[model samples]
Target: MRRDAWWVPQIGAFVVLSSFLAYATWAAFQNAHYEFGSYLSPFYSPLITGDSPHAWFRTRPWFVPAISPALLILPFPAGFRFTCYYYRGTYYKAFWADPPGCAVGEPRNSYLGEKSFPLILQNVHRYFMYAAVLFLGILALDAYRGYWFAGPDGVKHFGIGVGSLVLTINVCLLSGYTLGCHSLRHLVGGYLDRLSGRPLRRKAYDCVSCLNRGHMNWAWFSLFWVAFSDIYVRMCSMGIWHDVRIL
Candidate 1:
């Protein structure tokens, strides 16, 4: 194990990142003013101030209007399992890498270094990558629903609430983060060896290569921001903070 006194920064990063993630997870479980039913019809608006029977609550059940808990926690383990630095022996050197702390006398076998289950979770990153991307589409749908016309004033409006902005920003951050992934970039654009002489191949490869260079930073930053987005909405719902509406 490479021993250096640089563990402070690693530990600090882990603590700050984990704290934000935990808060976001907590917020995701809280109920916000989500208009799941109104989204079914673009012309639906509950704040119309008339007895139009189009009130949103009639169609929307009060069940959890957010994602399943399993999907919420998926990012934590999935992120830890596939972190490029961890498998490459960075964890042992930086105590902060392993939140559980390093195990003494841990054998660093190149093949099965950390054994079965945890290692198996590493493969899940590929699958979760698809899931994360799909969630972006959902966010986009939510953003579209955020737009509405004020019935009382008969004025055109495209107002955004806390939840809608959160959803939109979450998707944007995730897209940037996902596109900057090293493994994903390789999977999508690294097949250039098979098309070496193709005119557009080299250009594609160059683009992915540039993204790959900043992949690590983007991955972590995006992971944190998405969680923060959910927290922002949750806080707004809890009356802890106001979710600013943008027109």
Candidate 2:
């Protein structure tokens, strides 16, 4: 019989998550404005096949449907977040209301405990973790690319732009979140019996632990920055905003 505002955060989470999904889904389908200058939307990074000069592959094959390149790549990163342990708890409470919060009443009494068909799929989270790590590298490269802009004479010059800062911060936040993952932390030292002999492993484990401590903060910040980074690039591409050079 708790009378506190326990349900407040759940409602907040629902609204924030729903909005992100709606915007992300719409942006992925647009296909245009995901790339501007050297800045690339994380959703379309490693742009496998598209019109952007940063595309990792040649133009889309003639036989393939004219879908957005993002549709082809978003799944990997999306799967990572979908199966993330923290996100699992967050969404389960906000979306499913499975005991929504401490002392909260759940809708059903039966518990499957992640052993059945749907919940069992969460076991693939570690694999998705691998993909997330790889994306961090790709995004970091994109951030680096954001710093250079083509001058009027067709020459690229190194300079700081708002997009560059946005991209750099996005990758940094993502890195903190990804690197501190429970899977990555386990990978670092979970198998070892002792840290006495492995100095490097111990050091790595300590680093991961530090980030994991603030995992929730990292998750929220990175999520917001990622969507914002895309908006910045998209607006610059559409001429709604200019990529101002800071330096």
Candidate 3:
């Protein structure tokens, strides 16, 4: 039977996710502190200066050394998986609270089914898996960039600037999403002859399934939030808004 045709909620979600991603992509390229005279950077406030929360980025001629380029690369896999039919069948239906009328595109078959041209791009998940793993390592390095410098008082200080924090959380979220990948889950589960009397393999399968449950939501949320986090840091570095630290 054909899958139900629903389009409204799906379209709404697409719109919201698209808007957030569009603004964030532009923000990711900017300095951490961007400011306007009359108004602060949009959605940020308090105008922090000095070294209370973290050190600021020096306005440089070229790209800043500490910024993670994954800010740019991570979006590719996100866009891919968001449109994947597998996610539409499983995660989007449950967690996204997608209504019956919001099916932007209906699935034609199972994950192993045939693909035609653009639809075949779903296979690109394998390519994205490689990129996601490599970028995770890169983001870890970017997080460590905080440790490269110290405070003037000779204190062992690694500035957890807005950029640093965002990079850290972004990596964590990416890890969660990546772990949820069906390919990775299978890798962890292994291709065994049988599961009979195998406790460890069963345990691993259970763990992977847990992560897989929210895979789609995490994919989209992490993708969008990572970009937004970069924007928050960039605006801070540009001297446009304050990334206020409560602690």
TM-score of each: 0.62, 0.95, 0.60
Ranking by lDDT: 2, 3, 1
- Which of candidates 1 and 2 reaches a greater TM-score? 2
Q: 162-231, model 2: which lDDT tens digit per residue?
A: 9999999999999999998999999999677898889999999999989998998898899899999999
Q: Please state the error at residue 228 of candidate 2 in Å.
A: 0.5
lDDT of each: 0.49, 0.88, 0.54
Candidate maximizing lDDT? 2
Full ranking by TM-score: 2, 1, 3
> TM-score of predicted model 2?
0.95
**Weakest lDDT window of 10 consecutive positions for candidate 1:** 37-46
Candidates' RMSD to native: 7.4, 1.5, 8.6
Q: What's the residue-level lDDT of 31 in candidate 3?
A: 39
Give lDDT: candidate 1, residue 200.
75
Residue 64, candidate 1: C-alpha displacement in angstroms: 12
